[model samples]
Target: LHLPAPTDPLLRALHDILRTDPADNRSLDDHGRRIGASARTLSRRLRDDLGLTYPQWRTQIRLHHALILLADGTPVTTVAHHCGWSSASTFIDVFRRTFGHTPGTRPTT
Candidate 1:
């Protein structure tokens, strides 16, 4: 698979982490410091390279986790907690915005 050769050591380190399955929990702040880059640098790279900010990417990851939980008959409360939402209502709002339907209103079994 072709991948961009990173321009800096900091970015190269982050690129390796990015290569891993994103579902694996990773903290951008910690990764940034480990590679001698600031959190802002990491955020910029995430947006410039991946077209998303770190938080946005993380939120998307959590939302995907929520979908899996919901599909597997997990309770909405459990899903929200596990997916890192502050509350079920917030999770449902994001869920609806992203998927165009609320969790309880989905057609899936």
Candidate 2:
């Protein structure tokens, strides 16, 4: 999750938009339109600049925010909702797959 800052202007703008709302589930085309680029251009730039496709980057962003909220004692269901997961169970599955443990098992500081 430690992505370096994107040097490309478009990527930086896209990152700002994505960070503004992890729950923003707009299609790539829609996002592209918002930023005045074609989806293909955006996709290529994301891959080149960040080594992540749009979905991958978005998932990472969501998971990062989820960790912060969880550390603050947010409930699983609420965190799932805020992070744009379909449900708490889905979030738990993804979290377990990524971290090898349920969110509740995290050794919070």
Candidate 3:
């Protein structure tokens, strides 16, 4: 999705949180609170600035982290837990959807 250029402070803080620790396990609400905004405002800012829900952005970051960990030979369960996924199955599902195969299998796409 093409996003509007944003100079919103909340958006900037969200970007920093995502960038600082792609694997930060904090929930969206916690992240928003850390930056002194309401969750609703944070969500709206993300949608406005990045054309994505906060969860969507966080999931993308998690998938990237998963791929990196897989490439580094980290166990799948370990990676899932580290990335704050509720379970390995959720991680596998997201990995398959994102990479078109299971984690640790070299992505052909």
Candidate 4:
């Protein structure tokens, strides 16, 4: 989750919003209104600054939070809900796809 600081003010604002609630599943249009930008502008800014679409960036945010919650020994189902996945199975699928292993199987520090 070592993200580069966004140079654009709007992108920074968006990042702050997402960081505050990685579980937020708002549409780009909704988020744009919150940050005082159009969806297109926000999307372009994200691409320019982070080389990611809104969905991609949000997924990273969710995954970062998921890792932290898992490290704290939260149950997978609760973590999935806390991170905005529709269900534990969906979260597990995404987690497995992203990290090549399920969250429950992550090595301890």
Off by over 4 Å in 2: 107-109
What tens digits encode model 1's per-residue C-alpha lDDT throughout 1-109? Answer: 1224446566667656654434445587787767788899878876677677666766766776677778899999888878777789988998888778888885575
Q: Per-residue alpha-carbon lDDT of model 3 for 20-105, expressed as tens digits?
A: 67668788788878989889988887788778877787787677766777778999999998887889998898888876888867
Each model's TM-score, in the order given?
0.68, 0.91, 0.77, 0.92
Task: Show model 1 residue runs off by greater than 4 Å.
Answer: 1-31, 34-36, 107-109
Candidate 2's displacement at residue 73, Å, is: 0.8
Candidate 3, residue 26: the lDDT equals 82
Q: What lDDT does model 3 reach?
A: 0.77
Candidate 4: lDDT over CA atoms?
A: 0.89
- Candidate models: Cα lDDT each: 0.71, 0.87, 0.77, 0.89
Q: Which candidate is the best by lDDT?
A: 4
User: Candidate 2: what lDDT?
Assistant: 0.87
Write down the TM-score for model 4.
0.92
lDDT of 2 by residue, 12-55 (tens): 88888878898899988998899899999999998898898899
Candidates in order: C-alpha RMSD to true structure: 5.7, 2.0, 3.3, 1.9
